[model samples]
Structure formats: structure tokens, C-alpha cells
Target: MSKVVVASFVLCLLLLHQLASVEADDQMDRTAEAKSDVSEQKIDCKAACAARCRLASRQNLCHRACGTCCARCNCVPPGTSGNRDVCRCYATMTTHGGRLKCP
Candidate 1:
């Protein structure tokens, strides 16, 4: 009877440990999700557009258009030119003239 009691106690302890591990993992996942949400909403449009327009011939026009696109899309392609495939919103925006809006 005593041996059986010891075995049952050990099983309960193992189950408790497993439950704690699962809870910790769940908490970590929640934290990571929250961080990503915050980051997605806080992209620095100014810096991103500045980097994107660094090599433009018309600096003011490039910054203005890039800023608008970045503000609306919350993203900018990685370099000064091309690579619009990286940001669908930036690539697809149109001006009143039916031309591409972003530089």
C-alpha cells in the first residue's frame, strides 16, 4: 500500500511539472505575439522613406511620395530603387494621373 502511494505521488508531481511547462510556453507565445503587434504598428515611416529616396534625382518629390506611401502601407522596400515586390502596397499605389505614386 505504501509503495502504491509513493508511485501515485510521483505521477502527480510529473503531471504538475508538465502542466507548468505548458503554461510557461503559452505565456511566452502570448508575449511574442504582443511584441509583434506593437512593432507592426510602430514602423518608422520617415526613416524608411528617407533610406528609400536617398538616390532620387528629385529629393523633395521623392521624399513626399515615399512618405505618403510609407504612411499608408506601413512599409518600404529595402533599397533606394526597385525591389517593389517586397511591398505590394508601395508597388501598387497610383497617383491621380494613373502613374505609380511611390518613388
Candidate 2:
């Protein structure tokens, strides 16, 4: 009788541990999904800013303004630029590899 009780207790503990692990995994999945959503939003905001810059005649002001717009919209600043409005705006939106490479 004692042996049976011990076995049952062990089984219950194992089940509890498994449940905890599953809960942890679910929490991690939720976190990852939230991060993905934020990234998508940032990308969308950047694209919109790029479009605005394009329409503003290649002025650095447009691109610089776009970066600020992105920040207000909850995204990391793309970077700074010195070209005309169009090029600067494009760089601000697409400059991903650390620093801006000017021609």
C-alpha cells in the first residue's frame, strides 16, 4: 500500500512539472507574437514615411521629418542623411547596415 502511494505521488509531481513547462512555452510564444506585431507596425510606418519623402522633391527635410514621424509612430530612427530630400529620405528609411554609405 505504501509503495503504491509513493508511485502515485511521483506521477502527480511529474504531471505538474509538465504542466508548468507547457505554460512557460505558451508565454514565450505570446511574447514572440507581440514582438512580431510591433516590427510589422514599424515597417509600415517607415514605408509611409518613405512615400512622403518621395513626394517632397528629394529634400533632406522630408526625410529628416520622416524619421521624426517614425519615432512618433513608435519605431527606431532609421538614421541621419545629407543628400537632397529624396535620397536622404530613402536613406533614412532603408539605412540598415549600421552607417549611411554616401556616393
Candidate 3:
């Protein structure tokens, strides 16, 4: 009877440990998701596009196009122009007339 009791106690402990491990893994996943959300939020499209369009000759057109591209791509390259490689989506977007949509 004592041996049976010990075996049952060990089984219970193993189950508890497994549950705790699963809970820990779930918590880790939630933490990673939250961090990603925060990082995504940190990308301010308005401010980034404003900075990107600062040097353009056509300020209104630049801002409009940059705003659209930034909203779609969630990123802007680090200059007034010609760094489209940094944001592939911005680089590749096309207008109906086959011209690049982004400034």
C-alpha cells in the first residue's frame, strides 16, 4: 500500500511539472507577442514620412505619396530620396500608369 501511495504521489508531481512547463511556455509566447505589438506601434508613419519628404521639390505630392507608402509598408527609408531598397514594399509599389508610387 505504501509503495502504491509513493507511485501515485510521483505521478502527481510529474503532471504538475508538465503543467507548469506548458504554462511557462504560454507566458513566453504572450510576452513575445506583446513586444512585437509595441515595436510595431513605435513606427510613426506620419513623422517618418514627413522627414522623408522634407527635401522634395513638390512637398505636397511628396507628403501624399510618402504617407500612402508609409501606411502600407510601415516603414520609410532614412533620407529625403532614393533609398527605396530599405523598404521593398515602398520600392515596388506602382501607379496605374506603371510609375513608382512612392517618392
Candidate 4:
């Protein structure tokens, strides 16, 4: 009765403690994975952006947007005025209003 209740509460607390510890370990692993991905995914954003934006209608805005997209995705399509298929992620990303975000 009372003893059983106390035992169950203690067991539940121990289980919760174990779950929290596992969650913390999982978070640490995910953080490490993210760091590794960032290092591995670094790209020559300046050159990529310049190439992509060279013939754009709005050079300033194109350079800015292309640089941003290249940095995030580590890729830019070749001869990039309209060949966004080379980098599908960059091509598909959209603004809050559903407009294409990349240059």
C-alpha cells in the first residue's frame, strides 16, 4: 500500500533520470555532428557567387543573395543565370512569401 507507492515513485524517478541522461548524450552527439558538417561543407562562396551573379539583371542584389545561398548550401549551379538545376536545394529554397530566395 504505502510502501508499494513509495517504491513505485522511486522507480519512476530513476527511470526519468536515466531518460534525461540519454537525451543529454543524444544532444551532445547531434552537436558534434553539426560541427563536423559545417567544417566539411565549407565552399568558395565568393567565387561561386561572383560566377553566378556575373550576368544577373541586378548585380548587387544577385551577388548578395548568391553569396548567402552558396554559403548555406556549399553549391552554385554552373553558368548560373537560369540553370538552378545544378543546385536543387538552392533553387528550391523560398522566402517567407513563397518567392524563390536564391539568386
Candidate 5:
């Protein structure tokens, strides 16, 4: 029982360290983008969210979800809807039941 607990604690620590490192990498990416002059790579969150949810029947819900996701990831697919390939990070985000969470 003690050995199992020690192993679990170590695993948790390792997972947390990995998460912290990933976050640092993401910050670096954001920093690089800020320093770049590429207009195409600069995400206007409002416009991107609007574009992402333009065709949705539930406009309010779509706007809310898309807005949140866009703000967090700075990405949305280059379309009104569907074809999530271009927005890989957004596409892979999931709810508790593993359904796609981004609008």
C-alpha cells in the first residue's frame, strides 16, 4: 500500500511538471507571435469567433463557446463552420464526455 502510494505521488508530480513545461512552451509561442509582423497569424478574437459561429442556429451559444475558445487558443478554422483540421488545438479540445467542446 505504501509503495503504491509513493508510485502514484511520483506519477502525479511528473504529470504536473509536464503540464508546466507545456504551458511555458505555449507562452513562448505567444511571445514569438507578438514579435512577428505576420498579419495572417495575428488572431482578432472577435472576428475569428464571429466567423467560427456565423452559420450556427444557436448564435448566442456559438458566440460564447467560440469566443472563449478563440481567446484561449488564438485560433479558428478558416470557414464558417466544420473542417476542424486547420484548428487542430481547437478541434481536439473536449468536454468531460470527450465530445468536441469548441464551437
Candidate 6:
């Protein structure tokens, strides 16, 4: 191939490689952000449960049980309603005669 044609081809290849690398990085960033979001949600749920546990006067077994169940179940924060929350699982378990119910 002529020198000019070879140089042009090399440039195109470099551009394509850069684009692919950028796309890969973007995907990785998105995955990391999603993971971070989940972690934050878990922390928020735990905090909320702990606060509620501290405030309740009854100290019934159900309070701790509900908190534990909420921690274990999948939950999204409120305001983002329509998204799944741990309370739903607890409610389902209660309705279905499962072990985790408020006393």
C-alpha cells in the first residue's frame, strides 16, 4: 500500500480502539455506580430500622424480628415508591402465615 493509505488506515484503527475503550470504561462506571447505589440503600434501611427499634417502647420480639426481616429482604427507599421494599416481603410473609409477624 502507498504510505498515505497505510497512515490513514492506522489512524482509523486507533480511533476505533479509542472508541471501544471509552465504551468499556463507561460500562464499568455505570456498574460501579449501581453497586454503590445498592450499598447506600442497604445502609439507609439499616439506619432507619435501628432508629425505629430504639424509639419503640414495647420492645416486643416482633420489633426486632421485623427489623431483622427487613434487613434480610430486598428493599428500596421510600419516595421511590412502586419500587420493591422490604416491608412488602414482611407483609407478604404475615399474610401467608409465615413466621415473621408483628406481635
State which candidate has the highest TM-score: 3
Candidate 5 local lDDT, 1-103, one digit each (tens): 9999999999999999999999999999998897775644658878888877888999999888887777777788878878788878888888789888897
What would the per-residue lDDT of candidate 6 be over residues 5-72, giving only the tens digit for each residue?
Answer: 99999999999999999999999999999999976665454455555455456655535654665666
RMSD, candidate 4, Å: 6.0
Report lDDT per candidate. 0.92, 0.60, 0.90, 0.88, 0.84, 0.58
lDDT of 1 by residue, 1-103 (tens): 9999999999999999999999999999999999998867857888998898888889999999999998888889998899999999999999999999998
Q: In order, how many clashes per candidate?
A: 0, 6, 0, 0, 0, 0
The better-scoring model by lDDT among 1 and 2 is: 1
Comparing candidate 1 with candidate 2, which one achieves the higher TM-score? 1
TM-scores for all candidates: the values are 0.62, 0.49, 0.68, 0.58, 0.57, 0.46
- Superposed on all Cα atoms, the candidates' RMSDs to the truth, in angstroms, are 5.0, 8.0, 2.9, 6.0, 14.6, 5.9
Give the distance in Å from residue 98's predicted Cα in candidate 5 to where it truly belongs: 1.5
Whole-model alpha-carbon lDDT for candidate 1? 0.92
Worst ten in a row by lDDT for model 1: 37-46
> 1-103, model 3: which lDDT tens digit per residue?
9999999999999999999999999999999999998767747878998898888899898999989988888889888888888989999999999999998
- Ranked by TM-score, the better of candidates 5 and 6 is 5
The deviation in Å at residue 17 for candidate 2 is: 0.3
Local accuracy of candidate 4 as per-residue lDDT tens digits, 5-101: 9999999999999999999999999999999988797788898888887888889999888888887888888885778888888999888999999
Candidate that scores best on lDDT:
1
Candidate order by TM-score, decreasing, is: 3, 1, 4, 5, 2, 6
What is candidate 6's CA lDDT for residue 103?
Answer: 21
- lDDT preference between candidates 2 and 3, better one: 3
lDDT of 1 at 60: 93
> Among all windows of ten consecutive residues in candidate 3, which has the lowest summed lDDT?
37-46
